[model samples]
Target: MPGFAAHSWSACGYSVQKVYEWLLGSQQRVTWQPFVWNRLSLPKHNFLAWLFGKKRCLTQDRLIKFGVITDGIYYLCGAQQETQAHLFFDCCYSQRCAHLLQHWLGVYWQGDCVYWVIKWRCKSLCKKMIVMAAISGLLYCIWEARNKCKANMVMKRPEAVIEHVQAAIRWRLQRSDFVQQKDSTIAWIRDKRLS
Candidate 1:
């Protein structure tokens, strides 16, 4: 075999896993995976975040590509073409919601909120999970509000969305078992008024 090497051939013969890896090359871990799939997050929130990470959410730009809609204006802001980046990061509505949530959580993220959440440093993993859950909830709510606006339903105000996310986070924390939580983690929950 012209392209084959001795090391490439295993004595036990080829396996599906080996073939898959060879075909796909080395798998690089996504930075947003942990942020999207945090155990403390709700299922819907996790799903929405995963869609966001994959850029699979049906923003108006994608709809235009599909010819389902001719116009691509963002329903939330109505000031620019609707795009994954614009809707999630650049839109004033989303930025305001994110700002309020970040302020409430006493954290500031400059860019790519999901990446920021993954790299955020804190003494407690529990606190980190709480933050991840909150961010996930915020993303989900923003998408919901956008859809509502597109459908001509009453869209929630950014402050209202933040309040809803905060209440959801607090409710989730209340149901979580805290028996083995560290003192710092409990204190964080208390300080955030999530307990």
Candidate 2:
């Protein structure tokens, strides 16, 4: 009873926050958190990005490991195994979509797209938020396209996916009053026709 009392009162008092923290332990910061949870990004997009950052998406490779399916071929390109890395970074189909978005945004970086956004050194926080939202939107759209292909045996063109992401980003930007109303930001939004 003494040992139980000591353990229970270790935090001095029982509160939901303390209990929650105690159960979860120390939080490990991740590089992708800022990009994935940007205020400019949609909630669903953030959720998908979080899953992707965690490598928790049910990619074909994981599905195979789980015995959900035997084949691990990527539905997008059909030339590589569908892994979290392959589906998001290495697959030709996804690469094309990423390249198109990168070109449109005029933001270039090497390695994982999420990390690139995180490390981007733009002076404007607004610009960085826009980029993060767009990138998160791209990841969400790519996964959506993959799901469609899997369910209907049809694949959407990279252009179509890019268009969807652009529209979504544009919509979010238009509705966001938090965007910095600087001349450069305005000009950029006008140039991209995202306003």
Candidate 3:
């Protein structure tokens, strides 16, 4: 299982050796410890610039079309100005979702968007994949939820969104081999720490 995890991580541009250390939870823990625990634990170097090999959405480009600058407002959040940073990281609604994730992970919530995604460290390959999927799923769901809330389809609650993310993670993990081995690994990790 660890072997397969290594292969997956390497394929994703991560260092297999570093991943081994991370899986053992022996890596230097990042002090930022935002809303999600261990989601952003990897050093800056390990971060993939593109999410799942897809281009990142640039907010500055969107602003030109929205013409919010001429109108004295931001389109995404209806703020006085629109920028990529504001659209992804600084938006009020997104901040709430980020906060919810931080609380769920039992960690502090920092405001670094790119760093938030880059620092994740998972001991096992399967768990690492699951965590990545959960992060993406959470971000997607929040975006959709925010749009729905803005349109009056429903109200947005960060907790509820987080619940959706957890459900999504469970659904994905059930089909994979990771969950089958979690009980043993948990015990092993615990024992390793004690020794």
C-alpha TM-scores of all predictions: 0.81, 0.88, 0.51
Worst 10 residues of 1 by lDDT: 1-10
Clashes of each: 0, 0, 10
lDDT of 2 by residue, 28-138 (tens): 988888987799899999999999889899998898999999999888888988899998978888889898888888888778888878888989898899889989999
- Judging by TM-score against the true structure, name the best candidate: 2
Q: On residues 60-114, what C-alpha lDDT tens digit does candidate 1 reach at each position?
A: 8899999999999887888999998998878999999888888888878899888
lDDT of candidate 3 over 1-195, digit per residue (tens): 786575686577777676687668755664333323333222221232233123344334464666743443444456646454564557786677767665554345366643554475646644444445555666566555655764575766667777776665554444544356455533332232100
Residue pairs whose backbone atoms clash in candidate 2: none
lDDT of each: 0.82, 0.85, 0.51
Arranged by lDDT, best first: 2, 1, 3
Please report how far candidate 2 places residue 151 from its true position, in Å: 1.7
TM-score for candidate 3, please give it: 0.51
lDDT of candidate 3?
Answer: 0.51
